[model samples]
Target: MDFVNEDIDNYAYDHTQIEDDLLWRLELETYDQLEIPQMLTGRIEGRLLKMLAQLVEAKRIIEIGTFGGYSALSMAEALPDSGYLITCEMDPVAIQFAQRFFDESPHGKKIVLKEGPALDTLKTLTGSFDMAFIDADKENYLNYYEALLPLMRPGGLIVVDNVLWGGRVLNPQETSDHAIHRFNHRVKDDHRVEKVMLTIRDGVSLLRKR
Candidate 1:
């Protein structure tokens, strides 16, 4: 189901710099202990997230999913002294593990973990956000987009992960694939934002609110 050729993917990983010692250990531990460790963003994507946060100079960030807090920490490390990242996760168990890492790190204070349905929590947030990372439920991709749009400032970036759904998106048979395909189509024609789908780890759709 991988869209990219295996050799190319290997080459990409080889060319990219690996994460630092602490992050590398955290990522490995998450995979060893968690049920769905694949959900955790690894070295390549984590660095990409950090770089994007830096590019935007994002002061206030929101993450729809905080799997083991890997991505949250990655972005938080890129933030300025006053920047903050509010990350929400639906699973209580996952939240606990993420919190453990957050508490041990210097950037921990900047990360706020809200445990509950991301959609419901997002609806209650009143302040504007400079950036957002959406890696939650697949069926609610569009819903998440709509919910966050009003709160995202113009020129703000919203990155949606797993858009390719492990290459299932290219197929018309799988239900998840169809859902993702439809979501991609919906965003393509939306007038409120500018977007491009990048073939990152799992295909990330980067949208800029207009």
Candidate 2:
């Protein structure tokens, strides 16, 4: 069962802004060269990420899961000259592909790729951050949230991708679905933050540490 009706969901995607040519190229290349291409954040969501970073005028950003660095590059393009983005990815192959693209872009210097498990990397990062994006392992969504919350400044935004797990969260049968379901419910009730789960892409839960 789809959490959102088909007609309404289709309308939402239709109304959203489309991606530019460069991002479109990257999206195409990701599908062409990568095995788990679905892991890459597509055009629509990449634009959203860029817009969100612009809105916050974020100086320091963090991203877990740099699958081909699509999302990282998108957000990096939106940041000001002084802004920086620290992105982490556990997969070495994906990191290599992402690094290739990052090296070609003008904003590449702003993006610092950390190749390692995100949980371990997160521990090394201290002090407040302006924004964060989590799109890694689904089962550890809550763990990522807890680890990042303390590092994010009050009112800082945390955009988590794939929370709906391709509408699986509505079915209650899939393991990934249940994990996201639990994580969403937990965030809704968490007193330390305020949140809204938007049906963007699979789903994106936006959180603001209070």
- lDDT tens digits, residues 1-210, model 1? 346889998898788877777687789889888888888888778888899999988999999989899999999998887889999998888888899989988888999999899988997897689899998888888888889999999999999999888888877687677878888999999999999999887899999999
Residue 99, candidate 1: C-alpha displacement in angstroms: 0.5
* For every candidate, C-alpha RMSD to the true structure in Å: 1.4, 2.3
Q: Pull out the clashing pairs in model 2.
A: none
Question: Residue 127 deviation, candidate 2, in Å?
Answer: 2.0
TM-score of structure candidate 2: 0.91
Tens digits of per-residue lDDT for model 2 on 96-203?
Answer: 989988888888899999989999999999958989999998888999999999999988999998887887777878677888899998998899988888877688
Runs in model 1 lying further than 4 Å from the true structure: none
> Which 10-residue span in candidate 1 carries the lowest summed lDDT?
170-179
- Would you estimate the TM-scores of all the predictions? 0.94, 0.91
Per-candidate clashes, comma-separated:
0, 0
Model 1 gets an lDDT of: 0.88
